[model samples]
Target: MLLTDTHTHQYYETDPIKREELMQRCLDNGISRLFLPNVDSASIELVMSQVKVYPQYCFAMLGLHPCDVKENWQDELNTINAAIPQHKIYAIGEIGIDLYWDKTTLDNQVKAFKTQINWAKKLKLPIVIHCRDAFEEVYKVLLEEQDEDLRGIFHCFTGTLEQAQKVIELGFYLGIGGVVTYKNSGLDKIVQQIDLKHIVLETDSPYLTPVPYRGKKNESSYLLYVAEKVADLHQTSVENVAAITTENSKIVFGV
Candidate 1:
């Protein structure tokens, strides 16, 4: 079974030895493909370094994360925009409205979101969104910007069935992460109700670690546990889950 982690920050581990161990664990668990999304200008190098080491296993994406939309947000975008052409990127993201951390940056977050959406359109690439407690606000911008060219995954999606349908209608896939494994996350119900074609898998590693390891740090290797949980929810085999979700990742990343 070949598993894919559509969204992960495994590159954040700067220690070379630990990084290799992390990659080895992922490979051993059949988690072969990992897409890394950089949050700001500072993380660009880290993302690329991981991609460089495991070029065949890792993919890179660029964007300004909503939570990082501070006063110098413009400069951050400028740097990321300039860096885009220098490397090949599968998507422009981990970008979207994040009102959970600070509602005050909503305006800038929206503006940054739209800007990155345009970037994805222009580049003819998909986007990977990071919506947090601001689905309505993010959905509004997506509606305004909806078109044939706008397509991507709603990363870390934990919304209702209606919201999931809305996103699918817009030609975007729902990115299911470790949250689905949570006993009370409610995501498993929504995921079980939805078809696998409109869904993708992710770990958001170093963050939303899956069950049996929820309280500890997350890694791409743990994606196997998530695949198992999803398989259980959908009443399918882990191999089937891995196949469908990996194919979905290929569809989105075009890799």
Candidate 2:
């Protein structure tokens, strides 16, 4: 069974030995395709380096993460934009409103979100969103910017069923991550109610690690845990989850 991690930061590990080990673990676990999203100007190189080594396994997405929307946010965007044409990118994201970290940057976050959304539209590429504690704020911008070309996945989606439905209505897929495996995250219940077609699996690795390995550093191989949990929730098998979600990833990333 081929599995896909629609969002991951596995490239953060620069050590050649550690990186190879990580990639091997993913392959051993049947996780073959991993889409890497860079958060800022600095991470673009890190994302590309992984793609360079494993062109067949890793794909790249460029964007200015909401948290990085500081005083020099525009300069960051300029750098990322300039890098876009130099390398092939499947999406424009990991971008959206993140009010949890700093509420003061709400204005800048919205501006950056809109700017990146426009970038995706112009390029005719999907966008991978990173919304946190700002559903209403993010959704408002999506509504304003909704169009035939505005499509992508809502990365790390841990919102309510209502929010999930709203996102689906916008022609975007829900990026289900390790949170779905948490006993009390309530994401499993929400996911159970949503059709698998509207969902895609992700680890957001080195971040939201799944249960049985929660509280530890996450990696792409752990995507099996997420796939297993999703299969259980959907009353299916891991192979089935792998197939459906991987296919969904193809639909989004066009690979």
List candidate 2 stretches off by more than 4 Å.
none
Tell me the tens digit of each residue's lDDT in model 2 across 74-145: 999999999999999999988999889899999989999999999999999999999999999999999999
Candidate 1 lDDT for residue 238: 95
Clashing pairs in 1: none
Clashes of each: 0, 0
Q: Can you write out model 1's per-residue Cα lDDT over 39-143, one digit (the tens) per residue?
A: 999999999999999999999999999989999999999999999999999999889999988999998999999999999999999999989999899899999
What TM-score would every model get versus the actual structure? 0.99, 0.99
Q: Give each model's whole-structure lDDT.
A: 0.94, 0.96
